[model samples]
Target: MEPLTEAQRRTLEDLYQRIDERVSPIAGTHAWWPCRKGCDHCCRHLAAPLTITRLEWTYLWEGFQALPPEAQAEIRARVAELEGTQRPYTCPFLDRESGGCRVYAHRPMACRTYGFYVSRGTGNWCHLILGLVEKHGDGDIIWGNQDAMEDTLERLSGSTLSLFEWFATEGC
Candidate 1:
C-alpha cells in the first residue's frame, strides 16, 4: 500500500525493459501475431478479473490518476458494474469505443505477455492467434516463457490481488 521503493521501481522498470526487448523483434514481423493497438479480443475475453502484483497496481494507479476526470469516472463505473459478472467478462480498462486498453502502458505483466508468451509448452493466446498458428505454423514466432515471467514478477512484487480487490481496497 505504500509507494514503491526506489529499488522496487528500478526492478519493475527493468522487467518492463526485458518485456519490450522480447516483444520488439516479433511484434510485427510475423503475420500470425494478432496483438496490436485497438485489437481488444484479449481484453474482451478475460477468463477472470485481472490479477496483478502490488507493484503493478501502484504503477497502474499512476496512469489512472493522469486520465481526465470524466474518463476516470467512466472506468470507475465500469468496475462497479463488474461485481457479479460471469467468466470472460470485458476488461474495465478497455475503452470500448476505441477497442484499446485505457491504461496500456501501465497494464500488468499479464496484459503485456498475453499473446506473446507460452505457458506449459502451449501458446496462451486467443482463438485468432490459434487459427493463424494452425495455418501458418508457429516456427517464426519468438515466444517468451510465461512461467518464467510470472516468477520474475512474483519475486519483484511479492503479493498479488485481483483488479476488483484493488479497487475495493484503494477506494479510488
Candidate 2:
C-alpha cells in the first residue's frame, strides 16, 4: 500500500478532530464516563465490535510502525489469539500492562467516539450516562450514525473492516 500522503493525513486528522469534538461534550457532561487512563474494559471485551474504514486503519498502521520492535512483535503475536475462535480477546494495540492504546493519538474514529453517540441514535450510549440523561430528562440521546460514517469513509478509502479482523489479518 502506498504511504499516506500529507494531504490524506491531514484529511484523516480533520476527521478525527471532528469525532473528538463530538465526544468532548458527552464526556464532559456525563460523570459516568469512567474511561480513565487504566480503564480498558471496552478494548478488552470479548467479541469486540470495533469497526473502521481503510483510511482509519491505515492511520492505525502508521502508528503501529512507530512502536519499538518488541512492541511490534508483541502486537503481531496477539493476532493468533485474536484470530482464534475464542469468545473474548483484548485489542492487539491495547497495552495490557497499562490498559491503554499503544496508538492512542492515532486511534480510529470508533475508538474516539465509542462511549458517546455522534448522532441522535440511541441504545449504545454508556448505561450510566443513558440512565442519567433519562432521569434528568435532559435531552435526546443520539449515538453516532455508523452508517453515515461509513458513507463518508467509503468515499475516502472505499473499504471498511472490523478492528480485530484488521489486526488479525493485517487488514488484508
Candidate 3:
C-alpha cells in the first residue's frame, strides 16, 4: 500500500466528520444507549474479521505506527494467531484489560458506526443495544444511514479488504 495522498487524507477526515455528525446526537439522546467506553461486547465477540477500505487501512496504519514498539509487537502476534479463529474472535486492537480499543481514534467505519447505524432497516448493534431497545422501545433512536456511508466510503476509498487480509499482505 502506498502513502495516502493529501486528497485521500482530506476525504477521510471529511468522512469521519460526517459519521460523527450522524452519531453524536444519537449517542447523546438514546435512553439506554450502551455504547460507552469500556463496553467491549462488540470487540470481544466479532461475528467476522472486519472488512475495511484501503483508505481506512491507510488511516488505521497511522494509528498502528503511533503505538509503542512493545504494543505493536503484541498486536502483530495477535494477528498472527488470528488464523482459523472461530466466530467470536476478539479484535487484535482491543486492550483486553482495559476493554477499550488500542486504535479507537483510528478504528474503521464499521467500528465507528456499529451501534448507531442501520442498513436495510435493521440495526447493526450488538445484543446489549438490542436488549435496551427492546426494553425502552426504539422511538427515540436516530439511526445513521449505513448504506450511504458505505457508498461514500467506496467512492473515497476505491477498494475493500478484510483487516486480516490487509495485515497479511501489507505488513503492518
Q: Which numbered prediction scores highest in TM-score against the true structure?
A: 3
Better of 1 and 3 by lDDT: 3
Residue 117 in model 3: shift from native, Å? 0.5
Please list the residue runs of candidate 2 whose C-alpha ends up more than 4 Å from where it truly belongs after superposition: 46-49, 118-122, 125-143, 163-172
Candidate 3 per-residue lDDT over residues 20-126, each given as its tens digit: 99888887886467888889988989988889999999999999999999999999999879878788889999999999899988999999888788888665657
Cα shift from native, residue 119, model 3 (Å): 0.9
Q: After TM-score superposition, what is the CA distance of residue 72 in candidate 3 from its true location, in Å?
A: 0.5
Q: Which residue pairs clash within candidate 1?
A: none
Model 3 local distance difference test score: 0.87
- Put down candidate 1 lDDT per residue, 57-107, tens digits, no spaces: 998988888889999999999888998989888998899999988888888
Q: After superposition, how far is residue 47 of candidate 2 from its true place, in Å?
A: 2.2
**In model 1, what lDDT does residue 146 have?**
94
All candidates: CA RMSD (Å):
1.4, 3.0, 1.4
Highest lDDT model number: 3
Error of 1 at 138 (Å): 1.4
In candidate 1, position 122 carries an lDDT of: 65
C-alpha RMSD of candidate 3 = 1.4
